[model samples]
Target chain A: MYFFQKNKYKIMLVASTAVLVVCIIVGSAINRRKAGGASDALGTVFTPLQSGVTGASDSVSGFFNYLTNMKGYEKENEKLREKIASLEDELRKTDNLKSENERLRKMLDLKENEKDYKTVAADVVAFEMDNFSKSYTINKGIKDGITQSCAVITPYGLVGYVSEVGRNWAKVCPIVDSKVSVSASIMRVGNTAIVQGDIGLMEDGLCKMTYVSKETGLEVGDSIETSGSGGVIPAGIYIGKVTEIKNDVTGVSQEAVIKPGVDFSDVNEVMVIKDN
Target chain B: MNYVLSYLTLAVLFVLQTTLGRYIDICGIAPDIIFVYVLCYSMYNYPVRAAVLSIIAGIIVDLYSSTHVGLNALLYMYIGLAVSNFASTLMKKNVWTVALGVVVLSILYHTVVLITQYVIAGHSGFVYPFVRIALPTAVYDGVVSLVLSLWAQWLSMDKIRGL
Candidate 1:
């Protein structure tokens, strides 16, 4: 009888607690529902309190922020002053580029009078992410009348030759290709060299100039440009500058190491020598 | 009236689980309140009644959680049935004994969530998942279970008996 009574009491206790939990759940839910319905009361009460406190705090913060921000402004001002100096330097560079472009334009105009030299501007797209394949995709393709064997040139010099042409995109196998050749002229001494793209030397960002005599006046930093033979690229379009001249024991032909003007990787714009 | 309160409590617990629960995160997890609550009620109540309550609680949890339609309802109902049958062995008034209820339910809930998440993600790692997910959840629920169980006891003694 005692054990049964204790069991009955335990049952009652368990039942009541379950009821309590159920009640808490129900009460909170109903209260929340009721609170949600009383939007008018909440709007008049909570919004004003929330917004007023926020506005006041924002104003106070605005004052302190202004002071600290002014100190920041001084640091910013010093930065801005340096940036202004740098910008002035950039403007001078732009002016220099414009003057150089003007002289190149005159030279191009003289070549234009002579014959099939026509130019079309094309935009560059992607390149191999990490390869020394000095090639890039251009926006102009077959649709733009760009066909294979057309030379890609920059105002600075020979870029590449159009290799693949789709309706909208074209690929250029640049002067860096081992099979690629440019008849280059050493401008000062009028020495002629067959500039060949050397795959082994691509890592050093260089192309090769073969057949130049070792005794030629071509020195380090001497410029090389297309000689315009066979109407490939016009004569005097800056190809590259000679950096090294190698004379071997077999020395039938000395090779002048030419670094092309166009990095090819960073070339964003180019001119296609379509009619040239 | 009772059903209304039970649903309300589940909702409140869920809101707490998502919001205030974020702060209570000990090391980046919190107690499964619904699980602890389910455990306690299931153990103390009649087996059939526990099943019914568990269904309701599971549905509420599923609605609030990202769980698919009837998963939580089914899982918790089974837990309710199991716990109620187990609780029959001891007098429900034993506070320490009810704690074991909390542990069982915590493990069940965490396991269900893990399975559900894995099914949705379509990846199954090695076995003994509960050793990682469920174990920590069990610890969290154990603490919550102690507090809620005490409150249940106080309510049972102070006002429930008189009422």
Candidate 2:
């Protein structure tokens, strides 16, 4: 009887496994068809369950049966995460070395342009709790040699100028601000234009390049770099390039849409030009 | 007294909704999984238990959120009562019905939140109006309702059989 029960259970298990295998094949085929046909259907389990499958724990459990059986998956996951963390730490160190090497190269480029200006390194501290604000605060303050009116830049382009200084913190508003004016010139053709800010363009991280003559050689895709004619931006600061050129019927100058290189949302650090 | 399991489930959903569900933003709003689940429970005969479960779910969500405490509990309790009363008038378990009900409940949830945020922030909302957020959110909730209903139905299967 014991052998009979054991044999019966073994048969049941084999039969179910066979059925499960067939079901999986059929399910995948149906999913492929559904994926091919339906605009809204997310055919796979990973596809966001717009159908409310997620609130159902049983289904999720059924789906992730491997995780359910290996209850130590969370522990295993934690262990693997720690291992990944160590690997990431090594990667970060390597990335830092690469960035340092790049910075040294940029420093060489800057030295070729000018010998007088000193670059002050600073990291971002806080953003206004309101995401609507275009301002971000940084770690450097008056004590860290950061002061008001200093031109802060990232590796890619001119970020902003330091606006407010506290004992340990400073606030900066980027050149994309409607009120900011940077003396910029087209690098390819060397035609001068003033990059000006307007409130309508702030949310999009765009500043208008104004004062370009209609007869000027400025065109779309032209790289805009700092002219440094005015002591403000100190020349050679890589701003963005002309993306669109529009001319007003009555106006003398054509408007070139400049796409700012630094995505302010993801900006981590900036250098403040300190040598005055 | 396994209200603890119910609460834990809601907590898990809230965390998942904020962290993972955020990626699935439809028209810029995620589906209201907790609200839809509450809507599902209101389908059953356990009115008082459903209301209490919803309140617990609400409180758990509040704990995870930066919003004011007890607000979700209050919102969910009323939604539970309303859905319970409404559930008796209709009995079909079709996905569309579940989807539509979820849309209504999600609009209600988000309208309250938008109002709350407007009051707190005191800033201008959008270019178009008093509430453009609710419509997209409602549509997204409708889209997500079929699955959320399945969850509620599955979780409440034992209770449904009891009734």
Candidate 3:
């Protein structure tokens, strides 16, 4: 009893160190396993607290997003109105002539004709917000039928896919994360390439397309879209556009830098594309 | 009374760190406020309490973080111990003392994280992360801790009477 009382500080330090090591091992295993009961319980409690804080923060940022993007929105609105007026005039002339073309397009029954899917919408409740990692947590999860690897998209394009799930919250590894890779294709030329995030480019909010064949004739401004080869992400979801192209270090293949279609900094709402 | 005050301070700082403080990123780097607080508090006040608080704070941060759960707690515990053990000799009752401590600790923290996450793992090249993320973040932390230490001093002043 005397020894125990005297050695309390030493015991505490050693015990804490041991606990930390055990936590490291268990934490890594849990991360590898994706989700667990403990994390689910933590999420169940923390999701509400995070959501409350996120709601308040979002209100402040929403005002800033509106203020900062106001000019761009005004310019785009003006351009769209002008385009609509011109299109209206053109439609008056082509109204009768386009009837057969529309009929033929309907007859072809293209995949674009289908505009429906089962999706769960979620709000970004929090962000990882550190230089070492780039991820976000959404307020929807297993309770909302979300699963790992489900493609997340904004109205504009692909954001990323779910990496971890809990009862009420999930973590999304965005396309800008160094760990993320997507099978993408050139919309203009049908050339397939792997769009992967790089640590260097992620700081600037850009991704790189690698392993593209030289014969693909990849060019700047070409739209990139998901190829759906993995089947986790649906085909035809817009990824981004090629901004720069360069030869690989070995010169055997080509690489292109892309700007993602979705503005991640401004995204608040996202839809999870659940598999059928 | 002091423990409660410190605990409250930690809680408020953490909430601020996760919420509004996140938007304060410059060049994709944000200051580590909780880290600065722990280093400063340990130097100025109770060491053992600061160490325990750091662990608690680290766990809370890990709960919200994408990294492995104990990575931060482990780092914070070690930082807490280092600061507490050395504070009596190294720290002085001066703003410069706090400033220098924060500066050195911030760089050390980033270096350790980099070594563990990328260098030891060999998954990523060191040059880019060191230049772009780690160094810039340390600079940011230095600037932030300077101001934060000053504010903490102001809050603790006997003349202020209410804090």
Candidate 4:
């Protein structure tokens, strides 16, 4: 009783610390098992609030952007009008080519690979606040037929894969996250490599591709795409282009730096591929 | 300050941090507003209350983020305890001292995060992140903490004096 009275605060702190340490161990085990009961409950409550706040902030930012770029919009409109005229002429040629390609595909008995996957579009409701990881929450979730490890993409290119899913929301961890690694192939040389995220390159919106063979002959601006080695991500989804190449420290292989096609900072809407 | 009101404010700030914090990011690094608030609150409140608040804050962060649930909870609890001890021993509690504490604690927080990442994930290249992300964030948090501590002091002048 005397000791307890004399050091009540210190005792409390020690007890709390012990409890927290246990929680850390238990929580990490749960996380590894991908059982996110607590996270899902919290997400159900917070997702609506996040969606509302995101909508309001987007409107505010859109209004400001309109005000600041009025002149630029006028110039862009003029250029787009001229480009539309040329595109219309090109569309006629594309239609003819499409019909011819369909006939050729029928003759060769080839399937339309692009139609194999269905996608659900979702709006980004929130982003990770810390500097260590690159992830965002999308408004669509398990109810929308989204599942863990589903591939996320924009029209531009691959964005990432679903890391966690809740009833009404899911978190997408991008290719640039330190823990994500993708099996990729170089378009020109047709050689495969592993594109892995590095903490050093994440800040610059870049990732590193390693395990390249010595004879791969990688060059600047070589297109990289998913190799379909792992069935999670679909094949031939454009990931990035090589910007720099270097020899491995062990002199047995090479690595290259990649700049992803989709600029994550401005990504608002994403399509989550389903039934993959 | 009323504990209920303080917690409510923290909740609001956390919502804003997750939603609008990216807009204010400087070169892809966002200031940790929740951290600054907890540090300042710990300076003025009892260690036990501060610790409880820290655990709540940490749980909120862990629930929202993709990390394991208790990683941030453990980190924040220790930080809250340390800040409370530092404040109680100080000769005077003011904006300058609180700001300094924020800078120091910010560094400690990021360092722990980096170490944890290295240990758990086997992430390589420590110097790059320490130089690029950790140091700039500490300085940025210090500047924001200065303004926030000043505003908090102004709001609860009597409470501060009593402390």
Q: What TM-score does chain B get in every candidate?
A: 0.78, 0.79, 0.81, 0.88
lDDT (C-alpha, whole model) for all candidates: 0.62, 0.62, 0.78, 0.84
Q: Sort by DockQ, best first.
A: 4, 3, 2, 1
Per-residue error (Å), model 3, residue A81: 2.7
* Correct interface contacts retained, every candidate: 0.00, 0.00, 0.45, 0.69
The 10-residue segment of model 4 chain A with minimum total lDDT is A26-35
lDDT of 4 at A20: 76
Q: How would you encode candidate 2's per-residue C-alpha lDDT over A1-276 as one tens digit per residue?
A: 888786863464356445445533443354221112111111122122312333354356456887566877778899999999999999999999989977998987754434566887876543432112345556566667876777888878989776655545566778775436778888998888888654456556677888889988777888998888778667888899888898855699888888888875466668888864
TM-score of chain A of 1: 0.55
Error of 1 at B85 (Å): 56
Which predicted model would earn the best TM-score?
Answer: 4
Q: Which stretches of candidate 3 lie over 4 Å from their true place?
A: A31-33, A61-77, A83-115, B119-123, B150-163
Q: CAPRI verdict on model 1? A: incorrect
* Residue runs of model 4 more than 4 Å from their true location after superposition: A1-3, A32-35, B151-163
Candidate 4 per-residue C-alpha lDDT over A62-106 given as tens digits, one digit per residue, 9 for 90 to 100:
999999999999999999999999999999999999999999999
lDDT tens digits, residue span A1-276, model 1: 887786964564456446545644554354221112222232233223333343454467568889879878899899999999999999999999979977998987844344556777886543421121345556666668887668888766788787655555566778875547878888988878788776456545578888888678668899888887776666777889888877845776687788899875345578898765
Error of 1 at A155 (Å): 3.7
Ten-residue stretch with the least lDDT total in model 3 chain A: A30-39
Q: Could you tell me which residue pairs clash in candidate 1? A: A25-B8, A25-B9, A26-B5
